[model samples]
Target: MPVKIYHDEDTDITIVQSKVVSFIGYGNQGRAQALNLRDSGVNNIVIGNIDDDYAKQAREDGFSPVSIEEAARQGDILMLLIPDEDQQTVWNEKIRGNIKPNSTLVVASGYNVAFNLLTIPDDMDVVMVAPRMIGAGVRDRYVQHIPYPCFVSVEKDPSGTALATCLSIASAIGATRGNGAVGSSCREEAGIDLFAEQALWPEIMAIFREGFNVLREAGFSEEAILFDMYLSKEPAEIFERAADEGFVKQLKYHSRTSQYGQLSTMNRHDGKDIREKFHHILHDNILSGKFAEKWSNTKWAAEELAKEWKEVENAPIVQADERVRDVIKPDRKK
Candidate 1:
């Protein structure tokens, strides 16, 4: 089904302007959205928790930072831009009682709401405006007067204007300026995002790593392997061109030999089997709340993440990458 898009014309900016907007974190998304909103003429904006490095940075950026509970009490619209794992704890400890009745509670992602990780009050307006791009991308597009597409969802609407409020927020962040915002359900956004993170990204990384190992075993020089596999700009440039034009157009940019080889080998993988596996991972692991349950213990999650990073750092591919970089771009060596 085609999504209904909402643009600046469909949004009432005054609705968002009328409320005090408090960001509950000063992380990437939080800082970007807050700054964009302020620049877009949302006057009543504040940051929560003036204790961390991010909070100090927010203060330096001209935002008055308050505690989480203080922000919840002061703002009519409270946006939780913290990590997904931290949302439940923060909401339970600092937000629930302090959030005003009938006020709006916003989230950048639907993970917590979709998995029933949060218990939102019935009197509040719970909505989501998930940007399709990164926080830096959102800020860049806003400055250029371009729109970044976003997924907007209304999970609860105790206040009748919940959808409008979400659209208004999208407008402020330049998500409604170009092709406009795509209307979505909270569950759909959460499921897709989680699937991308858990299945698609890991699969891509595995392909790259295995390919690198194969080339190494074939006795290719580390520098040559690194450049061909990734480190060089060619792959990134091709992908960027493909995004701007079309994949078919991208194929035209390459030599006929390259195109023939790529097309011939593309179908070598079992597409149906791979898709079925993706479906299994998405439905059983992500949508079924199994992944969320595992990640609920933030401490364990952090340790696991650190362990993975350490493994990546010590991997042969990464070691080869470092050697190649040192030889070609020694200035980058720390």
Candidate 2:
């Protein structure tokens, strides 16, 4: 489907400014968004936790903090900025009954609603304003007056103004400043985001590790292997440039030999096979809810994942990375 992009001119900032906005968590998104909203002249704002360190920080930052239930009851817009794993519990225990009737319920991500992890009442407005970047990036770009494009979606709009409200919020957070915001569906955003996380990133990391290991096992020095694999800033700089400019434009910045080698050898990798495998993984794990089920049920999922990741940390490549960094970029330590 073609996406409709909305800019600041397309949004009525007063819509959000007039509403009482309450943030349900003080994590990355919460802090950045709440600050942005306040700075954008939305004065009726509150934090939904009163006991946590983040809550204290919010208070210190000059915002009154309340309990989740109170915030839900009082605010016209309740933005749930908590982790996906904890959203359902918070909704059932503190939000469902207490939230104002016909008010807006906002989510930064559509994971819970897309997967039916939480149910919304028909009387309320359910919407999402998912930023394309991290919370810090959102705030930084907002400060710089640059557009940080976001995905705006309306799941249930009983009041008939959910999309407008979403766009208003996006504008307040500086998402609709330059390039504006992309209109998308909750399911689309959730599926794409989850697929990227569960399939794409893991595949990339696996390829990196396997390539490094192959070179190391073939008698290449760890220092040389690390440099070629990633420890050097050259690949990182190329990727950073590619993100801002198109990959084709980025290619022009590379040496002719580098560009020719990359283009010519690209087909040597089994691109079709890798894509098929990724599709299978996405279908079985993400679309089928297997991954969510495992994550929710596994008692020590984070710890186990950390343990699994220790292999990369303990690898000789990383030790070589330290040595190389010490010589090439010693100031990085500070």
Best by TM-score: 1
Give the Cα RMSD of candidate 1: 1.4
**Residue runs of model 1 more than 4 Å from their true location after superposition:** none
- The residue-by-residue lDDT of candidate 2 on 1-334, one tens digit each, is 7679888899999999999998999888999999899899999997998498998889888988889999989989999999887788788889888988889989998888888777688889999999988889988988888777799989998899998998899889888888889988778888899889878887887777778778888998777877777766787898889989987679889889988898888848768987898889878878887776665533556777788788668876566677878877889889
Give the per-residue lDDT of model 1 (tens digit) for 1-334: 8889898899988888888999999888998999999998999997997598998889899988999999999889998999999888899999988987788988888899999998888888989999988888888889989867799989999778899899888888888987889899879998999988888998988888889898889988878887887777898989899989998679889999999899888857668877998999998999899999888778988999999898899888888877877888779957
Off by over 4 Å in 2: 268-270, 297-300, 303-307, 310-334
**TM-scores vs. true structure, each candidate:** 0.96, 0.91
The TM-score, computed over Cα atoms with residue i paired to residue i, of candidate 2 is 0.91
Estimate every model's Cα lDDT from 0 to 1. 0.88, 0.85
